[model samples]
Target: MKNSFYLILIGCVLLACSTSKPEVVMVTKTIATKDTIRIANDSLDYEVIIIDAGFSSWLDSRAYPRKYHSLNYLESKNQLYVSEWNNRVLQPQLYNPNLYEMTINYDPMLRYGYEVNYLIYNYMIYFQNTNKQKLFGTVPTR
Candidate 1:
């Protein structure tokens, strides 16, 4: 009887452990656009893939002043770019308030006059956390 009771207890423990579910994590944001901007490693790494649109000319015009005036500051640092364009221009219209399709990349170390990039970065962070939570069943503490 004693042996039977011990076996039953051990089996119950194993069953409970096996049946336990991992914690659920939630991703707060979703990246729907391929041109979505992302910043990683505390903004040391930046990538901007602009969708195919007429925005490139606009970005070039706007980014030129920053590039020329802040040459030393911009040099060797990761600069923002469109999907295929090599120049950075800041066209006010490129960041169309009406068009929600443009993608932007940003560095936290650098600030642009545009508020859209800031919004994109925050949105990405939210999306990343939410995604991690979904995958691991728990939101990352970070």
Candidate 2:
């Protein structure tokens, strides 16, 4: 009977150890290719932006259903700055700033249907004063 009780205790200990959460690691690297960015394994719902000198075939492949509207117009340069409205946070103080500035380098081709290499920039926006603070907050302790 004593041996059986010890066995049960050992089993409980093993189960508890197995259920412990694993640690997460963060690493940053720059991309030098035209491939779509891989989503992080631990990422939740977050906004993203891509700024390109012009659109690419790769961009079309990863395009979301929602569309972006032009945010500002530069008449002198004849260029329009655009942003995804769905990714913007509607907070008074939290401004979704543009993060990337890609310059086009590729020649115009029939496949891509463009002559300029697109300069692309990406941005991730978060609301500063939303109840969704827990989205970026620390994990709770039980």
* Top candidate, metric TM-score: 1
Q: What digit string (tens of lDDT, one per residue) describes model 2 on residues 22-110?
A: 33232322232352222221221111122222223434444322223221211111121122221232332454323212211211111
- What TM-score does candidate 2 get on C-alpha atoms? 0.16
Cα lDDT, model 2, residue 105: 21
For 1-114, candidate 1 gives per-residue lDDT tens digits of: 222322332232233233223332212222224333222222212222223222233333323333233433332221322221112123435433222222233223333323
Where is model 1 poorest over a 10-residue stretch in terms of lDDT?
80-89
Off-target runs (Cα >4 Å) in candidate 1 are 1-45, 58-66, 71-142
Whose lDDT is greatest here?
1
List runs of model 2 lying over 4 Å from the truth.
Answer: 1-57, 60-78, 82-94, 98-114, 117-142
Q: Residue 140, candidate 2: how far off, in angstroms?
A: 40
